[model samples]
Target chain A: MMDAWDDYSEKVMDHYENPRNVGIVEKANGTGVVGNPACGDVMKLTIRVENDIIVDAKFKTFGCGAAIATSSMVTEMVKGKSLADALEISNRGVMEALGGLPKVKRHCSVLAEEALKAAIADYEKNRRDISPAA
Target chain B: MNLIYMDHHATTPLDAEVLAAMMPALTSEYGNPSSNTHAYGHAARYMVDSARAQVAQLVGAPRPDDIIFTSGATEADNLALKGIAHAKDYMPARNIVTLAIEHKAVLDAARRLQKENVEIRFAAIDPYGVVDLDDLAAKIDKNTILISIQTANSEIGTIQPIREIGVIAKKHGVPFHTDAVQALGRYEIDVMRDHIDMLSISAHKMYGPKGIGALYVRRGLKLTPIIDGGGHERNMRSGTLNVPGIVGLGKAAEIAKRDLKSESERLLKLRNRLEDGILRRIEHVRINGHPTNRLPNNLNVAFAYVEGESLILACRGVALSSGSACTSTSLQSSYVLKAINVPDFLAHGSLRFGLGKSNSEEHVDIVLDLLEKGVRRLREMSPLYDMAKEGVSIESAHFSRHARGK
Candidate 1:
């Protein structure tokens, strides 16, 4: 039988092998973590959101190659975008960037998008709490 | 890359001797066994009868007539469950009792039977994947018609207590069936001694040709035919015989019987060496399945920080399965490991190695080396693994509460 990696595109395999932006951003302005412990894939995304634009983004994910690659791709996708634009970046965009994941690994792409939104949401929550604009 | 096949539970390479036995059938011996009135037919009939006797002997059944040929174990399983459930004599006892971890063939058949208003009861298994005897005892009542459990799980390789379960079935007077597709060639099974009323075996699983199998039904038991046709195989199964495949199955069975004891011993030693090597080399790794009751040729281990899919993908040089091939398409890890209450990380990270005739000490060592390297590489990329090594409980780690229903 053919290996499961055969279903993946060369780009997905490349991103998985040499994942970019790996590690934590401690004391970051906004941090998002998503995934179910029961499901065996988890993601923690840290972002430096300054003046409504994402200045820097980094990720640490625990999942299959697709999830890790998607997270890495998501970090790159949102690096220079506004929070609204980052939020607009869909899971499909991440999957497309990676060429594609297998049918079974498509769910990992969703994890990438969710982790980003969660980080942005965390930023909004932290901002609202600190600001008198509430 | 030269791939070393470690996935014997999926299927095995055809034995050379079995191929030799099947050559005549595949070549010049093309006579129809049903044409018994002439020499051409008589010769075919002779080959069929001899093959039938070999199959019966392998399973320790008294009468050769007790076996019915089918396409494969899937068909055999379907016939056993559906044939018996549809039997006029068994309608009053309308319940089917089987384990949760049975192959999809048995489980799917039971689902179909349930749709026909047959009550299907799934017996629970313990943490080690052994059927709970107490749960089974409570489930099998007078209304339970058939009790089906696998002799050995195809994924975890945990062998069930079939003899004890068979004794219970006998006490309740319910017919017992076992999907012995994985156990027959690897272990010894005697239908009479085990009180098995019916058993399922497939040729491809035993180093025989594919597309052939047999269902052993205790004599004097009547079955409602699933395939109604030329009334072949004493009306139990109907259709033209797969003469070549049958000959291969027969030869495979004969060889299995002859080599079972010695081969199992060798496999056991090799399996232990491979398993021990992995345990010694890696941290946070565990051996899955029963400690003593597992198949001699099977080794399942859970690598703490890696997903099985990723591991198999990287170690393409060693052919392996994360679970059964049937369910590998799904991403939910393994239901067998889940049913046994193994943690999700460990369960998702498990690999099943089915050592067979082709595997040797060299192959085992290479696989172990590949596994150690692969697990280490994958763990380096896993952040949850980072937390684990630092003694931080993953369950206690704070996670953002994004709505996950989508």
Candidate 2:
């Protein structure tokens, strides 16, 4: 593409311009960090849960607009969904949520999905570690 | 409306004196510098020689005869690499050493050479873009034909210790070439004192015309010409001398030499104010490159959670570039940033702000304000920010329960 961002939808631009979720969450059920040294992007996701419902979601991303926006959109998509449903949230779904991404920015959506999955896995493992002999 | 031109590192406006000097060559001096038979040819030849002297003086070279004009830095770089490599056709061993953060003019040249079974060794770099001198020293061996590095980086504006690198190369009996396109008038350089074998410079970088440049060759260095023709440029390059360009280059160099020190100081002050303002107003912003060994007018910063391209687009009226300018062609980001170990996340969010003679304190203030507002707005729409505010780490919420955004 002549311009990498020219292909982004309005929703993608919106999320990129006004990202929904950003910052950090401490001492939570799970946390995940993803970094791509090639592109110089880093992402850290944290989540809180209460009885199978995510209470809150936050992220700290050191990436471009697409990466940040994708993270924000992913958090919004998974906020109230069950862990199983969130895990099923593919990168495609995140891209769809933002109306689609430029081919170059495809990695941004992938990173968002990976971060979410990583965080969910962390939460599941934590629950298993603290379970009362279920 | 005054259009503040702070992107001098990108390209400088042609100096008026240079334009005046070039007019006669363009209008009446039509004979080729190589054509020794006519007045036109003699005049063009003299202009070319005068231009060469001007360029040599700016770089502290001993004589004008040591310089060879080229299309620009890119061509000069290619000639330095391929010309030297091809010259060693009689030798069996072929190896090259260069830093990871070199401009594509060098890096891509190395890459192309590698395709021909040449062994390429890249020196590691610190986050500040300094070549690991020890690592470079260790990589040197008998077969090491050339050590290529740049004087100053265009992206982060990091200045490499070319003199030190030259000494190391000499110790190993290797030829040293530096692409000083970004360093020509901005920094003090002496080809002989620094022990540099070959140096490339472009006119546009120093307020001369574009598509005109020169390469400095030490008195005794031997290399074949990459371009073939009527034996111009002392049989090193073949094209007829660009008389108008040469005259323009000479005038520009004279002007740059006269005003360089004061202009640099002014640019430094403006850059400092801009940097200080951004650091104070923004959260999670980091400056890239070494504080002390960088260009006075260049500033690179990482704004967390914001994309460099987006920021540039939002600030469309600002007329600044994002990192290396060359990497704008690819989604892969800047090779300079990658080589310096800038994390992909931060690299993607990197912004390159180069100041020029046209920029003033007022321009800096405007840029600072626009940047602050732009980043804040982008952060607000981020879902990650919302989740963090709610005291939830995405990892914990991922496995047990998913709360789809309401």
Candidate 3:
């Protein structure tokens, strides 16, 4: 029988145990929230973008180990990347960066991707509202 | 790091004395109890009979012959429900009344009977998981053949009023069956006093070997056999007796009966310490199940902002179980919790702490420290906690609908 911890990869455990950038980005231009408490997982992603480049990223998540790890990994992956490159980061990309997640935990990675998209969308909306003719 | 096991409701480590008693049966007493013509057979039969008496004594049965050994509680549950349902004497009665929060053993067996044209009526339970006696009595009719309820719940540890339910069943003239798997060693159960017609119990839950259990049937009660063969177990169950496991179970039962009072008091103290520490040290935690009418060893709590699996993983050395969707294969929270109308969020955050004989005050302290750190850490990362702190109404957040769609 598989022990509960056996389902997680070493990378997943490492990230879960030592999550990086685990707070909201101060004065962030964009913020995204996905998932909900009812499903037992939720994620909030915040980003600081300057000159169309992602300068800082942080997250707060309520979820299982996979959700926390994927949130941590997504934030790390998006930092220092251009907005276009960050937009291209998929759930599979987050999963791969952490070696691999159990099949059931794959959805947690999707939450990470959606939170990123929502954050970027928020940033774009803020820019559009600030200057309609940009 | 030494692992502290608080999941005793799942199973317990075999007792030293039980193992010592089982050694002779496992090594030299290798004989079929049915082979009455040989010395080996006589020895095995003697052990089996002694084990049966021990089990009978533990449950306050009138006779040892009333105990029918089986593989485990699941098998015994199946036999009880199916055997009584298929009995020619009660075939005309088609309804089996049971509680909605019963273990899957009884519920699934009842479901199987449903397919065979037998009606299965589930009675309602209170928020604390106690059966509503009035509702249960209302569900039973003239055609009801059996009323199955559990001695106690595994997830929340709510002890039912079994004797009252038994009296109701007796008044209705329907056979009462209880899955006493979780209550065997923790509580005193007398089949005669409780008015129970049949009861299922397992050994592993009481520090005995696995794959051994028994069903206590009231004297003079008639039921059709679920398994048919050489008419072992009074023609009710037929199989070669498991000599070693039986010996272990008997020894375990003896130990349990000897230590029942003192052990329960000790476990109750540990459970209270753990529960009190969590309630005092943690924020937004809700205790589940009955406050006073619960099992001495069980403490279930739901931390407001943290997911159960995350909390479990964060507390690495403490072995526990959760009623969270994340911990289950079907991605659904505990049905027992749901049956009691615990909200989805709280249900997802629920964790069960089943204290056992091996636990000590030092162990409880360590677990408390771990739980405090884990819940605090997880809450720090939880967006839900942030919203709650900011005075946002969680029920109005509208993210729950999106979660359900997944």
Full candidate order by TM-score, most accurate first: 3, 1, 2
Please list the residue runs of candidate 3 whose C-alpha ends up more than 4 Å from where it truly belongs after superposition.
Answer: A1-3, B88-93, B400-405
Error of 3 at A18 (Å): 1.6
Candidate number that wins on lDDT, 1 or 3: 3
lDDT tens per residue, model 2, B91-159 = 777889998888788888889988876788988788899999999999888888889989999989999
Which digits, one per residue and each the tens of the lDDT, describe model 1 over residues B186-215? Answer: 889999999999999899998999999999
Model 1 DockQ reads 0.42
What DockQ does each listed candidate score? Answer: 0.42, 0.16, 0.60
Native contact fraction, candidates in order: 0.42, 0.23, 0.63
What is the lDDT ranking, best to worst?
3, 1, 2
DockQ, ranked from best to worst: 3, 1, 2
Task: Give the native contact fraction of candidate 2.
Answer: 0.23
Instruction: Identify the candidate with maximal DockQ.
Output: 3
Query: Please, what is the TM-score per model?
Result: 0.93, 0.77, 0.97
Candidate 1 Cα misplacement greater than 4 A, ranges: A50-55, A80-85, A131-134, B323-327, B389-398, B401-406
